[model samples]
Target: MITPSVSDPSPRRRSEKSRSATLSAALELCAENGYGKVTIEAIAARAGVSKKTIYRWWSTKGAILLDAVTELVASGSPLPDTGDIEADLRTHIGSLVRLFTSPVIGPAYTGILAELLHDERLARAVNDELVIPRVALVYQRMRGAQEQGQLPPDADLPLAVEMMYGPLYYRHALGRSYPDEQRIETLVAHVMRALRTPAPS
Candidate 1:
């Protein structure tokens, strides 16, 4: 309604508006009424689109939520490349800790992750679409560190990345105690130690 819904003559413009509306509605509903209570019908109603319109793009409610999350994640801050791997990891991981605790996206994303457990198809798509791409970005940063002799050349980057995030993800996904600044700092310290990066001499 705000942006010339009276309406855009271009089909692409109409599609873009509809997509944005649907994604926004999904996030709003999830935040207002817990992810479990967010249904496709509710999203369609709130988005001002028919159920068929939603289904034409997404197979299920989870798929819609996944797309919503991917859009938000894509717009978020990228990993810092200040050239000090330890400092960079701390900054990046700190951002993630905040993301896990974020009120808007946290609950919705946690729900999608839980849904992934029962839906094998969604799981594969999430791994391929969301998780793997983010992981790859970190790996790219660590590879740079290897070239600079910050992390050892043979460092187990994948496992080390896991070590950085596994505990935090476990707590956040399970709705456990929060990962506050101190807790995140402690985690970063522990993982950096495991990397065996040389200290400034």
Candidate 2:
């Protein structure tokens, strides 16, 4: 009896399988060997695909990592809104700090920043594709807090948002600070203090 050829499977199904495997390989290699060390050949070899196949989907290693990070974030980690801006900010910001310092994704993301400094296209993709949408959700939360009297009516929500996340990114991503539970709480409290409305006289 003759068996059906592997190519008998739908091309779309095979394409998706290859895509998922490639992304998983990229993430694994990035975690094991820093992003700077990850190469298209390495990802292809790990994923059991060919270099041409990787290049067919992604141009650079950074591009592949960007796609991986995008998929990770899109799954289930949006900023939470519980009708308490302070709680939401603390949870969101702390989660970001942890994510940026985690063994798996942190290394992968660190190298992306270096490329973003020089690669204008990747920079835009990182900002427009990854950063803006998440930040926009935080902005919406800030607006809600302001409307509900948690923050000042005329507070600089955009600037405040920057201030809130900037230090965490700078310390963890750029500098090298790892926030513990106490430290995260302190930082959250600081942000809350800055944004909280004053009590009536």
Candidate 3:
């Protein structure tokens, strides 16, 4: 009796292709119909894959969306890292504002924030996968500033992060208005001022 040879599929390549297709379809559907209206069936249809294929990898639509947004934000843009902390932060925040204001991203962001309000799991996933990495980058920059004596030794890094991000997120997610260049510049200046001032002795 002849025996068939055992062979394993290329897991890395297969997984990469699967992830790419899923993210592409998720972003497309999310942009077109908003996240609330997108279903696994719709994403699978757009991706030309079986629903089982998506479900095999992701447990929920939000999970798929989280991955999709992370990929989109990471791929299209490089986070700013100028040696000057204030300049770098202004560049970073400006890029963020442009991203949030884009026609392709605005609605998707709004949808994601809306879902996050109601879904703890999805919120956690988004925070872990996307927000934390970027936040860490900002923190690293702040630490570097402290080391360089650009910011006071006692600067509150976490509060500084919130100060930089709070206005941008609030304006975009709540007010539905994009931050203008002047607003971004002012934010950077204010944060820099706060960073420079020494904490009360």
Candidate 4:
């Protein structure tokens, strides 16, 4: 067993602190100035860290913004397993609606996603950082429902997920509207009806 010096700042701990500071700064700048106006230098200045530090961690402001959004989403309630998939899904969808319609994070997310349209790499990173984890949660919940005989074994989890969230994303992309509670209820019901397994003869 190798004993480390007590005064030594562990590299991993320092790295984590740096990362958290950078994300916080990035999110703040994006929210305050809109994503289009935020620069790496601004983020570094806000974070009181070096621009090189930001560059060493992320290749673009888009990547940092995605990380911040992912952090925000992950901090929210996880998908519920309340034995009622519809209710659980409604709650999840409602949370997403609120998140994307909020005054702070909403504009930030919208700006970053708009930028993502022209940058394939940034889009991929956003998908990896933001979309995939949320999809995995929904997929996992759907699989559990399948095990409970709520869905067919061959239930198209991915398609069902898209059906549930695609419209929300579309609305945000267009900056035209947002789903109210009734709309969320309708979407959840539609997806559930589409996803449920038929009764056996």
| Residue pair clashes in candidate 3 | none
- In model 2, the Cα lDDT at residue 167 comes to 78
Candidate 3 local lDDT, 1-201, one digit each (tens): 554343544667676777788878887888888778989999888888888888888998888877777776766545565668888888888887777777676667777878898889889988988888888888998898789878888889999999998887787677567768988889899988987877788
**Which ten residues in a row are the worst by lDDT in model 4?**
1-10
* Number of the top lDDT candidate: 4
Q: Candidate 1 lDDT, tens digit per residue, 1-201?
A: 546555445678778888889999999899899889999999989999889989889998889888888767766636888988877877777777666567778878889989999999999989888888888988889889889988787678898888877887788677797667777778878887877864455
TM-scores of all predicted structures: 0.89, 0.85, 0.88, 0.88
List candidate 1 segments past 4 Å from native: 1-7, 197-201
lDDT of 4 by residue, 1-201 (tens): 555565766778778888999888888887788888999999898888898888898998888878888888887646889998889999998888787777657867998889988999988888887888899999899889989987888778889999988998888888878888998899899888887755455
Please give the ranking of all candidate structures by TM-score, highest first, separated by commas. Answer: 1, 3, 4, 2
lDDT of each: 0.82, 0.81, 0.80, 0.85
TM-score of 2: 0.85
In candidate 3, position 146 carries an lDDT of 85
Instruction: Compare candidates 2 and 4 on TM-score and give the better one.
Output: 4
Better of 2 and 3 by TM-score: 3
| TM-score between candidate 4 and the true structure | 0.88
Off by over 4 Å in 4: 1-9, 197-201
* Pairs in clash, predicted candidate 2: none
